[model samples]
Target chain A: MEELMDILQEFEPGVDFEHCTDLIDGKILNSLEILSLVAEIEDVFDITIPTVEIVPDNFNSAQAMWNMICRLQEEE
Target chain B: MTSYCSFPFLFLFLPAVIVVYQLMPEKKRPYVLLAASYLFFWLISGTLLVFLLFTTVSIYSIGKRLDREGEKRDALLKTAPRDEKKAIRQLCQKKQRRWLALGIFLQLGILLTIKYSGFFVENMNQLLKWQQIEPLIKVPQFVMPIGISFYTLQAFSYLTDVYRGVTKAEPKLSRLALYMSFFPGLMEGPICRYRDMAEQLSAGGKITYHQLTYGVQRILYGMIKKVVIADRLNPLVQELFDSGTAYDGGLMFVALFAFTCQEYMEFSGTMDVVIGTAQIFGIKMQENFERPFFSRTISEFWRRWHITLGTWFKDYIFYPVSMAGPMKKLTKNTRKSLGSYYSPLLAGTVALFCVWSLNGLWHGAGWNYIGFGMFHFMLIVLGNFVEPPVAWAAEKIGLNRDSVPWRIFQMLRTAFLVGMGEVIFRASSLHQGVQMLKTMLTSFTLGSVKNGTLFTLGIDRHDFLITGVALFLVLAVSILQERGIKIRDYIAGRKTPVRWMIYYSAVLFVVVFGAYGNGYLPIDPIYAGF
Candidate 1:
């Protein structure tokens, strides 16, 4: 979870990823930024984020993203 | 069948379907909808209903096969060793891909051949002529089956979803057909995903008094939008756009703004009617618009307008392209040098390019549509590219990006940019669009608008007055919606006399002022052609 927050911070410098649940819904991270975040998370965590998992529910918050990464890891 | 506003559709066909639907047994209501949808398809496209049938069968069968492969893979995974599980999964994945590929080819092949064959052949012939060879290929003209473009995308989405395990394979054929051919969505669409409409189909809820009245109210609102505003703007828009007269800058700007207004009122109005019709049947359809004019940026504008199509491109094309293996590599390679902000852009721009090119072509087999797509593509890319600088400049100047004044300025700027794209969309050709923009920019004189220039097009001051009033009514409604106040609920809560009076007044307003009767040169529901 801390690792996920760190990655979100790198993509959007000042966003409160720790508290911002609307990161996806509020358009804080637009599509391209989401792409960058996805790639970085995959590298740091060693998990593949499939296109199906790229929905708002999985990326709307740091916790949501952490949940998705954990799930992908479990699947692997 | 001419349009939703046509007497036959409003008076005869729709009411008949509703009556029959209500009379049918609860469990059988969905089938009644299926029959009515097929009948509507038959009325418009005749034997071409076969195309819809073909796709319905294709998705059902392929989906089941994909599901079977999933089952086989899961079963094997439970028994196999960890190392062997990977191999088993790959083997099943190969089979699923083959089936999915076949489904895509079969579906898109028909759309490509019927919709784009003429454009391809004509362009090819021109290429051949340029090479000093006699052009010999004849362009084939095919009448596109109504809703083919819309349903094909829905069909594609369903198949892709099943393959991705986003949605399960729909075992029933009728339910799938109803999804593809729902009469309200048949001609143009909000492009429902199977999951979105699946529950509504199976539920077959009864149309209550509230649903009926509210549904009619929604339909009436749509009627006013289409007839009072869009239809009234039609001739003036057509003349300004298609008439070869080189009008002054005032008229050109009118042409620019007028077509955008007409397209919005017509398309969104159609959605109102479609959604309202769904409401009458106690099935809630997704909204295709959300006050697009209120948007503060080109990207935000697309998210609001023709919303389903925009999201369709985003989900199916944009994300896939961005996440494709090549793009993944591109993003990784760029990150080290360009840093976080700029790295993903290189890959994203590629995805945007594909989306826009296909989006433009999807509207029609014309270069102007492609230009319209690229026009927006450039705007969005430029917006992304300049964001950091713009933010820096804003902070330096003490401008609040989220303040009312700043937001208004952004909205107006976005509207101006969107209006120009509308001109390109409505132009006869890409060359014409460029010429119109050139003339609009170069020949500026506001005095021409006041000198009786407006009266000469096709409509008079009376027509202008009615459209203005109608537009304001829509604007008031939009403003309320944007503020999160539901006008329908407000009206619904009013006293019976007040509600009925408002309802009667609305009906009379449409009946008395609508631009429909004879001599009105059949108002084409604009997006239906696309």
Candidate 2:
């Protein structure tokens, strides 16, 4: 979780990614930032997140992204 | 074939469709709608009904196949050992991706072959001639089907959503077909997604009195905007743009601005009628325009105008390209090499390039259209690049960016930029657009307006007065809407006499001030050809 927080902050500093659930819908994390986050998550967790899993629901909150990473890791 | 605002459509076709639709049983209402929609398309496109049918059948088949693959993958995951589950899922996804790709390619291929072949061949021949080689390619003219661009996008969205698991693949082909060819949106569209509209379309219910009245009132409002404001300006805009080089810069500016106004009224007015017509059937379609003129920036202007198209491109093209492997890698490298503030922008610029290029070509297969797209791209990119510097300057100068004067200035600036872009879009060709711009920049004379040249362009004083008054009313209503006041609902809450008076006046305004009858040619919906 700390690692994930670090990644989020590095991707987009000063965003309240831990608490904000409207990250995608509210346009907080724009398309480019989301892509950056996805690449970081893949590198750190060593799991390939499928394109379908790149939805707002999976990346809106830090916890959601963490959960997705863990689920993909387990599947791998 | 009559337009949505024409006498035949307003008095005859719509009434007939509504009566039949309302009288039919709930279960059979969809079929009635399907038939009506096909009739509408047939009337406009003649024998091109086959194209709509082709898209409908192909997308339905592909969606069903993808859904079965999804179901199979889930079932396998349930039964498979933990080690094999990943492999099984990957296999299934690969197969599904192939099917999705096929579906997209088929639709886009058909669109390109019909709509863009001439453009492609012409460009190729130009290049060949420039190289002193034989022009081997012949530009083949096809009677391009109407709404192919719109329906193709919707079809792709449907297939994409199903693949993404955002929406289930519609199992019933008939339901999918109706969703694709709904009459209200068949010509120019808000581009409904399967997930957003499928259930509402399938569940055709009884039309209540409120729905009926509201729908009729909305349609009347649309007619007022179209006939009174848009149609009235058509003659002047046409005359001005057709012989753009002949006019002085001042007159040319008026022509460009008028064309912009005419386009907004015509397109958004059509949307109002389309959405209103759908409302009478108890189906609420999405709103396309939200006072786009009020936007203070080109980017915000896009967010408000033809809103669904922007959203669609963001979802399908912008996001996918940004998040694709190359862009991801580029973002990472930029963040490390150039630091955080500019990294995302670097990646965004790349994706934006794709989006804008496609957006330009999507309008029409012309160099002028491409110029229109690139012009906007340049404005947006320059805005992004200059934001930090502008903010610093504002802070240094103690200028409150939020002040009303500053806001108004921003709005005007954006409007000026947009008007310039529209000149290129409305020009007959790229070379003509360049010549028009040269004329605008090199020459300026107030004498044209002073000497009655403005009035001679086809509109006299009476027409100007009517247009001005109607435009003022539109502006007032837009201001209210910007402030979140629902004019329709507010009027609905008034006393019966007051409400009826409002309704009657709206109808009367169109009938009295509208540019129709002998001298006026009904301008087809601007975006319909696109």
Candidate 3:
């Protein structure tokens, strides 16, 4: 979770994560950014992400993504 | 008749469909929409309805299959041994790529055959004749089914997302098909993505009283923008731009500016209609525009204007090229050899080239469009190159990027830059674009400005008066939006009297000043050509 926050910070320098609900909703993060984030998450958690679970809802909110990562790890 | 202007569809067909749609059972609504969409296409292109159906079904099935295959591949990756997993992953990736390529090629092939075949055939014939070979190809004449390019691109984007595993393939074929053929987004898009529209498609929510009122108001705003402002500015622009031999320096400059305004109103106004129509259907499409003219930078202008298409390219084209393959290699090598100082600029230039070339091709099979794209690309790239130096000088001189006056100055500068690009874009040809640019740059006679040639472009004093008022109306709406007071939200809060008054005025202004009735040759929606 700390690592994900660090990744988000790297993408958006000086952006406050608390105010980023709209940023995620607006799809301001392009697909490549999403891919990079997914790569980071995969590496950190060491879980294989199933393709079916990669939809917007899974990644649209920081909380949702945290939940997804937790769930993926629990299943593993 | 243009689909928007068709009497039967607007007055008879649409109203009947809306009522029937609301009354239908929730499960039956998709069927109702599907039937209506098919009927709508039939009205326009009769048997070209088959092509539309073919496109929808192929994409829908392909999307579902890709999703399933992707899942299967992932499962295989999980279960396979480590050494085998690597090969399996590669194989799965290859399979996915092939499926995606097939889907894209099928969609793009349909689009090209329908849209560009005649152009290609004619050009090929010309080349062959020049080579002293008998012309083997004949230009086939086909009335391109309305919305083919728009819907096809929408389908392609949806499938691509599914392939990328970013969006799920919509399960129901009917829902997927309806999304593609949804009338509002069909012609020109804030190109609907599956994830955005999927819930809207399945939920057969009955229209509320407020939704109806809001929809009507939205439609009225679109009508006023299109009919009053865009259509009014059309002839003046056409006469000036195509009237090549008529006027000299200053009149030509005004003409160029006129073209800029005309293109904006037409395109954005048409989008207002598209978005409003989607609103009526209880689907919220992405806003393709913000008050683009107010952008303080060229890059910012593109971000705000035709935002969906721009973002689509940035995601699907620019980012991939920038972060992968030859360009990525170049960036890494450059950084290693010469430090990181120039790497971003080099990458930006390459990415911009890809984006602009694709942007130009997306417009049409035309050299002029390519020129238009490259022209803006050069301007934007130049803007980026100069930014650091300009910021440094400003800092040295104590100018601030944050100051209100400086922001206003930058906004005006960006607007002028955009207007210049519009001149090149809206010109008849590359030669005309060059001529217009050269004249605008070199010829600065005060006498030319004082002359009546500016007024002679078919629009009279009355037209100019109406245009001025319309411009104010647009500016006022834009200012409200700029201040973060969304028009819809404000209107939603307004008293009924005030709201109704606004609605009535929109309708009245459109009816009174609109150039569509008699003397106007209906200016086709510009993006329709794409």
Candidate 4:
């Protein structure tokens, strides 16, 4: 989760990831930033991401994304 | 008077519909909205209603097929053997894929033939004739259907979304129809998406008094922007560009600046009207502009101006190109060869090129538009390159981004950049654009103003006054908006007498000041040509 926050800092500096649940909803992360974040998340967590779950709602917020990462790790 | 939005229709047709709609049962509201929308389209577009109907039925049916195929494919993938599942999925998807392609191709084909055939044919004829050969093609005149480009794009986006499983296919035919031809968004679009607007279309949500009042006030703001600032700026812009030989550098530059403001106020103001109208029906449409003139760079200019189109390009074109196999491999290869820093830049440039070129082409089919795209691409990429330097310069100058003068300077700089782009955009041809550019650099003067150059463009004192008043209204309204004030709240707080008076006064002003009577050519809504 901390690593995820670091990656998001690239989108807009000084973002408080803890406060954001509507990342996608609020358009805080554009599509390109999302792609970059996905790559970083995959590398950081050493987990593969399926393309099927790349919908906007799943990544709209930091919490939603954190939960998604947790779920994938549990499955592993 | 012939415009569906004219006095008689507003005073009679719209009010009657509203009265009857409210009197009717709530369950039948969707049907009523559909009827009213189609009737508006039919009345305004006449026989072009057939085109709207055709699009509605074809897209509606195509959505149904795509949804079924998606369901079948998902089911097969879960249970069948890998080979069998793959084969079954491909077979099921093929027809659906073709149907979607056919729908988009047909829509674009119709748009091109109607909108671009004359220009295409004329250029071909000129080229052949210059070679002393008999011209193979002759240009034909075609009356383009109003709102065809906008609605076609909207329908295509909706269908494309459903096909991709980004959103579900809307099941109800009438609801789909309403979504496509919803009166406010039909003529010029913020390009509403199915996933974004579907729920609003199906259900007429509860409207707060605040919303009702703010909606009407916003409409007033939009009307003033259109009638005053935009219409006023049109004449000088036309004259200077139409005969560039007559103006010196200073006047031409001013003309260009004025045109930029005119275009922004005109288009964005129209959007405000569209959003306001939707708000009246408790529908929340996407906002299309956000004080784009205040952008510090060309990239920010795009983000702030015509924002929906920018997002559409990013989502539909840029993302796909950046992530697609070839581009992905290029990014990977760059990383392998040049390292990570170079990879993102390489990918970003390719993505930017695709998006910007498409953006340029989306404005119109011309070399000038292509140039317009390249020009902005250069600025944005260059802005990126100079980011560190610009930051250092700002720090050295003790300039804060939040400072009033800095903000104003950015706005002025953006105005200059955008104004030059409009010169090319509004020019008749590349040669004319070049000629205008040259004249802007060389033959400049304030003498033309003293010699009645302004009057010769066709605007008079009345036009200037209306423009001035309209601009004041727009600025006042925008200030309120910036302060987080919604116009509806103010109107909602007012007594019924005050509210009704405001509405009636707006109607009167639009009727009187709007450029619709004799001696005025009804300019087709500009984006419709796209």
Candidate 5:
């Protein structure tokens, strides 16, 4: 989780990714930020996220994103 | 059959549809609507109704198959051992993916074959001639079925939404078909999403007095905009845009601005009719325009204008393409090489390119249309690039970026950008667009207007005055709406006499000033062709 926060901060500094559950829905994490976050998550966790998995429900919060990473990793 | 704004549609078709629709049982109202919608499509598209039916059947079948596969997968995953679950899910996904791909390919294939084959063939033949090879391919002429671009996108959205588990496949094929061919939106659309519209379409309701009055008022309001403003500007726009070299730069600029206004009024006016017509049926379609001219940026303007199409592209195309594996990898590599600020923009830029290119091509299969897309793309990209530096500079200069004057300045700048793009859009060809631009830059003179050169165009001075008054009324209403005052609701709150006075006057204005009858040719809804 610390590692995830670090990656999130590195991608978009000053954003409280740990708390902002509406990151995607609120437009806090825009399309570009989401792309950057996805790239970082994939590299950090070594999981290939299918395109369908890249939805707001899966990436709107840090916890949601972390859960998706874990699930994809376990599948792999 | 004329457009929705025509007397025939207002007096004949719509009244007939409404009376029939109202008399039907609530459950069977959808069938009435479906029949009316098909008749509407058939009237406009003639034999091209086959294409709409083909789309409806194909998408419905694909959606059902996808739903079935999804259900089977979920059921199996529930019973399978934890260790085998991932494999089973993947297998199911792979199969479902093929179906989704097939659905998309077939729809896009049909769209491209009918809409773009001539352009493709012509360009290919041009290339062949350029390379000193014999140009053999003859461009095939096809009368594209009306609203194919719109309905296809709506259908594609449904299929993809179901596949992504965003929404379940609509079980009833008739319901899905009605959603696809909903008459109000069948021609030019606000482009309803399945999730937004499907249930509303299926659940028919009795029209309340409020719905009926509000719907008629809205339709009348749209008619005023279409007839009083847009249609009046048509001949001048045609004259100026067509004969670019013959006009002075001042007139050219006037023509360009006129075209912009004409397009907005016509397109948004048509949307008002569509949304209002839907409202009378107690089915509230999404709004397409929200006073786009009031936007402070090209991007914001896009958000306000043709709003659904923009959202559709953003949701379906931009998001997917940006988050795809290749784009993710590209973002990573760019971040490593070019640093953070620049790298974040890379994925967005690529996705934007796709969106804009498709957006431009979606408008029409012409170079000018593509140029229209590229024009906005370049502006947006440039805006993104310079934003930080511009912000820093503004801060350094103690400029209040949020001040009213600055906001107004930004709005004008955005309008100027949009106007230039519209110039390209309105031009007969790209070469003509360039010529228009050149003439505008070179031959500009304010004296032309003072010397009554404007009168030499189609509209007389008295006609101009009427158009001016109508435009001002529109502008005033737009301002009020922009400030969060609901003009319709406010009027609805008044006493019956006052409300009736407003309604009667509105009707009177449209009747007196409308550009119809003997001399004027009806301007088809501009976006309907697309």
Candidate 6:
């Protein structure tokens, strides 16, 4: 979770990823940012982020992203 | 009927279809809609409807094949030892991918050959001539089936979704067929995905009084926009664009702005009617527009405009291309030095180039459309690349980026970018597009607009006044809608007489001011050609 938070802050410096649930809905993490985040997560966690798993629900908050990362890792 | 807005369609065909749809048993209603949709396609495109049928049959079969492959893989995985399970999965996955590829090729094959082969042949002939050789191939001209471009994308989305396990392979052929042939979305699509439409297409319900009233109201509003504003401005737009060099840059600017207005009104207006028609059947279709002009940047504008296409590209083109094994590997390698901010952009830029290239060709086989695509590509790339620096600069200048004035300025800037791109998109050729652009930059003076020169082209002061007043009404409605006010719901809640009065007034407005039937040529639905 901390690692995910650190990565998200790099894309949007002022965004409070921990508390905010509408990261996607509120336009904090847009498609470009989401792309960047996906690449960064895959690099750090060594799990492929499939296109099917790139939905807003999977990346709307830090915990959500962390959850996705864990699930992808478990599947691998 | 040739158009959804045509009297024959609105007055006769649609009403007849609705009456039949409501009278049919709920279990049989979807078939009625599907049959009507096919008839609508046939009415417009003649025997070209076969192409749509070919797409539907191919996708439906391929989708089921994918489902079987998945089941086979699961069965194998169940029996295999844990050590060999991954290997079996990988092997099965390779086969599924092959099937997916074939399905995509088959779906796009007909579209590519029918829609773009002529352009390819013509370009090839040009290249051969440039090499001092005889042009061997005759430049073949072809007619595209109406909705080929729109329905093909929907088919593509369906195949990919099934492969990705996002949507199950629909076993029922009729459901898949209905998804592809739903007449409202057939012509100028919002390019719906299968997962979005699969259940909605089959959800049968009767048209209630509210549904009927609201649907008719929304359809009327769309008709007004098409006839009263978009069609009204068509002559001036045509006159200026057809021979803009004869006028000052001021008039060229008029051409740009007028075409932009016409395009938005026509496309989005059609969407209103499409969504409204679907609403009558109790199926909630996705919206294609969200007041795009209010966006603060080109990127934001695209997100708001023709939203489904943007999402389709994001899902199928941008993400997949950029995040493919090779691109992801590149992003990883670059991240070691270029870091997070720029690394994905490297891969993203490459993917965006592909998307825009295809997007340009997707609009038409014209070089200007490709140029239009390239123009937006540059803008979006530049916009992404500059975000951090622009933020830093804004902070340095102590600018409140969120202020209304700042936002409005941003919106205007975005609108200008869109207008310039539309100038390219609407131009007859690339050279003319460039020439008009150069004129706009170099000889930009509003003298023509200030003088009485505006009245001469096609529209007079009276026409301009009507369009302006009509536009103001649209603006007022958009503003209200933007503030989270649902105009339809608001009207629905009104007293019966009041609602009737408002509806009657709307119909009267269109009847009186619509640009048709008296020396006015109603411009065809613009995107229908694409």
Best by lDDT: 1
Comparison by lDDT, 1 against 6, better one? 1
Worst 10 residues of 1 chain B by lDDT: B517-526
Root-mean-square deviation (CA) per prediction: 1.6, 2.2, 3.9, 3.8, 2.5, 1.7
Task: Candidate 4: list runs displaced more than 4 Å.
Answer: A1-3, A9-13, A24-32, A42-56, A66-76, B1-5, B77-99, B117-135, B204-212, B333-342, B392-402, B450-456, B461-466, B490-523
DockQ for all candidate structures vs. native: 0.68, 0.45, 0.14, 0.25, 0.52, 0.57
A1-76, model 5: which lDDT tens digit per residue? 7899888887778888878998876767766666666676777888877667867889888899888888888767
Q: Over the stretch B43-116, how does candidate 2's per-residue lDDT look in tens digits?
A: 88989999999999999999999999999999889989988987998899899999999999999999999989
Clashes of each: 0, 0, 0, 9, 0, 0
Q: Kindly list the per-residue Cα lDDT of model 6 for residues B136-242, writing each as its tens digit.
A: 69877778899888999999988888887778999899999999999888889878888888888898887898788778888999988888999999989989988
Residue B167 in model 5: lDDT: 88
How big an interface RMSD has model 6? 1.6
lDDT for position B15 in model 6: 92
Per-residue lDDT of candidate 3, residues B158-183 (tens digit):
98888877789988888888888877
lDDT by residue (tens digit), candidate 5, B90-197: 898888889999999989999999999999998899899889898479899999888899999998999999998888998898999899999889889989889888
State which docking tier applies to candidate 5. Answer: medium
Q: Where is the poorest 10-residue window by lDDT in model 4 chain B? A: B1-10
- Docking level of model 2: acceptable
The list of candidate 3 runs beyond 4 A from truth reads A1-13, A17-76, B1-9, B121-137, B336-341, B446-449
Q: Write the per-residue lDDT of candidate 4 for residues B1-530, one digit (tens) a residue.
A: 24323455446765665566666666677677788888878777789888888888888988888898888778877887755864775687686788788878877787778777886788788899899898478678787667887787788788878877788988888888999888777777888888888888777555456666677667666766666567657767777777765677777776777677777877887787778767767789998998776677787788888888887777677766677666665665555465444455566778899888867877777878878888788877777666667788989998897788888887788778787788878787766776777788787777767776665676776777787777777677677877789766677678989988988887788768886566564334456566
Error of 3 at A14 (Å): 3.4
**Highest-TM-score candidate:** 1
Fraction of reference contacts reproduced per prediction?
A: 0.66, 0.41, 0.00, 0.00, 0.66, 0.41
Candidate 2 DockQ vs. native: 0.45
By summed lDDT, the worst window of 10 consecutive residues in model 5 chain B runs over B335-344
